[model samples]
Target: DGQKVTVIATDYTCIGEPVEINVIVSDLPNAFTPGSDGFNDIFGAGAELTIFNRWGQVIYEGTEGWDGKYKGKKVSPGTYYYILSVFDANNTKTTMKGSVTVVSDEK
Candidate 1:
């Protein structure tokens, strides 16, 4: 999640223009494993997440969480992109984009 802040400048003469700023307040993981061992088995955030493949194809879209599967099959281990749409308390939507690697099970 993130927040929007407005800063105004005043120097005893008059108020200056307000500068709007978008502040990021969440840290997402760079990798995860859906090996069904109950440890990092799902990837999720406090917002609507849309996952995409390297070719810009959507693999998953929802808030429930991704189990590293597409169409009932496990995805190949690699880096995938994501777009997170977070709405702040002020109803301002912020989009955060990044990549998360899917680690294959060693066993």
Candidate 2:
């Protein structure tokens, strides 16, 4: 799981005072092996995960994470795109986008 974040603004009165908002995208592990032994059953990063198909259609979206399945069925091994959004304690949002590959057990 990713770390929890916090943000605080000292001066809320100042409009466009150049508030320094830091956005950091942690490099999560690119791949996970979700075996059927009840360990690592979910194959996704801990942050908010959004998966898009090759045609740019969002296939899955959730906060608990992706379990390498869609609509209660396992997805075939292939490449997919993911967008992870992390929010700080002060409600600052940071989003990270990347790609990942899912491999079958035989491979």
Top candidate when judged by TM-score against the true structure: 1
Every candidate's lDDT: 0.86, 0.70
Work out the TM-score per prediction: 0.73, 0.66
Best by lDDT: 1
Cα displacement (Å) at residue 90, model 1: 1.4
Question: Which lDDT tens digits does candidate 1 get at residues 13-50?
Answer: 88799988777776777899988788988886457999
Q: After superposition, how far is residue 103 of candidate 1 from its true place, in Å?
A: 0.1
- Among residues 3 or more apart in sequence or in different chains, the pairs in candidate 1 whose N, CA or C atoms overlap within 3 Å are none
lDDT (tens digit, per residue) of candidate 2 on 14-102: 64433434445576656655457565556454568899877788888988778778787777777888998887656777888888776
Q: RMSD to native for every prediction?
A: 4.0, 6.5
Clashes per candidate, residues 3 or more apart or on different chains: 0, 0
Worst 10 residues of 2 by lDDT: 15-24
